[model samples]
Target: MSTFQAPKGTYDLIPPHSATYLAVRDAIAAPVRRAGYGYVETPGFENVELFARGVGESTDIVTKEMYAFETKGGDRLALRPEGTASVLRAALQAGLHKGGNLPVKLWYSGSYYRYERPQKGRYRHFSQVGAEAIGAEDPALDAELVILAHDAYRSLGLRGFRILLNSLGDAKCRPVYRAALQEFLRGLDLDEDTRHRIDVNPLRVLDDKRPAVRSQLADAPLFRDHLCEDCRAYHAQVRELLTAAGIAFEDDPTLVRGLDYYTRTTFEFVHDGLGSQSAVGGGGRYDGLSEMIGGPALPSVGWALGVDRTVLALEAEGITLELPASTDVYAVPLGEEARQVLFAQVTELRRAGVATDLAYGGKGLKNAMKSANRSGARLALVAGERDLAEGLVQLKDLTSGEQRPVALDALVDEVRKALD
Candidate 1:
């Protein structure tokens, strides 16, 4: 074994499993791409204040989980703990808001770093495929994002997930609700840290998962009840649009996301099979986030689906992705002379768009055949000095255990036909 290992709370995706991660990412990004969301990529790290101000200092992600550090130039930077803030910063920096298009749509797939005590479905380094629709406050946009996420999960055969929806009243009423919630929480018996959170961010206190904390929150004021008239109308329209599109969701009055910028619509996608870390994905409208990060007041909505969690969900629900074989054809050379010719043949087959692999190190026919079988290839191209001399190669149908001789010139065409 190598002396060094992957960092704690991190993993290395290898071989067949890595293919599944790619498929999940592509599956999640497909609907957004088709909807005109251009792909955007940002640096893996950004100015620490971007997340501190945009993601909210009170949230655990910023306060406890962020991987922040100082550079040699004395600038504080942080590995992005989440996607939206960095994405929004990029849009603002690029001046996408100045364009005529109301909402600057974008999609991204990459790894994010956090310093959490990792467990199942949570990691220090995780991957997410995210979509952001910036510069719009339309309820239809919110509904569209939710529908896209739902479609992505369904397309991947994830059936046991449910969407939880809520509204955290916007600027007009959130302050009033915050005061009420803080007042209610202060009266309860809470520790100094928990009580301090009520002053810093009262909504996060509601998100507390501790049994002791949750037990006292039963009668706490709900933001949905305190939503302003405009926010109420907006929330109602979002729900109506979702219903009209036949997407099912439950109104979760207590579903406050773990961010400070989210206002109006807030939601989460949960799968029971994931145990304690049930959230597969979630996002909501952040009408004030642009301004929070020192940009123009551009309203935006987006969601990020966890690639690792989605894979786990697939396993929990007993769904296999039915991935295509890694190799469509495996070439086996029986002798030294056949090796040179077969290597050229393998290259030609691959150049012709066939997934062909070659058995190297001069294995005997039996061992090479075993390697071919293990490759999950549907067909094996076998050639010996005798066959090569005859200007032909032996093609074995792995599934059917059938063999035939094909002219060397027709090898590529025959393999393509067999694959098709």
Candidate 2:
């Protein structure tokens, strides 16, 4: 082995297994595309202040987990810890919100970095397929995002996952609840850092996972009880829309997403099969994020599904994705002349939309056939010097162990027919 390794908390997705990752991402993204969310991509890193302001400076993501650094030119940049801020920043900079239709819908998939202690389902470097609908405040948009996410998981055959729903009160009522929560938190016996979070973001205290913190929080004030009329109405409409769509969800009063900008509807998708890192993916409506990031008041809703964690959930559920073979035809060429002839035919087959692989390095018939079997190709194309002289090749059905001679000129058509 080489004396090198992927950085701690990161993984290399290689080979046959990587196919599953791609399939998962596609499954998650399909529904959003069907719903008219156009695809968007952005740089993996962005100006540090964008996240600090948009994702919340008080949250652990900015304060501790963000992989922040100063550039040689004195510009501070951070690898994106999440997708929303960068996506919104890009949308704002490109004036999509101003030029396009309201609720500029978008979908993105890529890696996000965080400097956290790694655990199962919680990697420092992870992949996500995300969707965003910017510039709309309709609760239908919120329900659409949630329904799309749920549909994605189900499409991947993921079961036993629950969508936890909550509404973090909007600007008018959140402060009142924050003060009451801080008052209760301050009177409890807590560590200094936990106490400090109370002042910086009292809502975060409710999300603490430790039993000690969670136990004390049992009596804490909830945002549902304090939501202003507008926020309450907004939350009710979102729930109604979800119910109308036949999407089931549990009301989670404690689901204060680890972001400060979530104004009304917030949600998390959890699976008990994932152990402590139970959250497979989660996101919520960040109606105030655009203004916080120096853009106009564009209300938006979105969600991100973890690609790696979804693969884990699939494994936990004993579900296997029915992935197609990487190669449809494996060509085993027998002599130098036959190799040259079959290589051209292989190229033609590939051009005809057949997934084809050729045996290289002049492997023997046995070894070449072995390689063909290993490739999971359905058919093996074999041509010896004698066969090439006869202007023909042998097409072997690897599955049924049947072989037949076909005209070399008609090879491409034969392979296409077999594959179809």
> Model 2 segments beyond 4 Å from truth?
none
Could you report the Cα RMSD, in angstroms, for every candidate shown?
A: 1.1, 0.8
- Please write out the lDDT profile of model 2 over residues 29-120, one tens digit for every residue: 99999999999999999999999998899999999999999999999999999999999999998999877689899999999999999988
The digit string of per-residue lDDT tens for model 1 on 35-114 reads 99999999999999999999999899988999999999999999999999999999999999899898999999999999
The lDDT per prediction is 0.93, 0.92
- TM-score to native of every candidate shown: 0.98, 0.99
Q: By lDDT, who's the top model here?
A: 1
Give the RMSD in angstroms, all C-alphas superposed, for model 2.
0.8
Instruction: lDDT for model 2, please.
Output: 0.92
Error of 2 at 165 (Å): 0.4
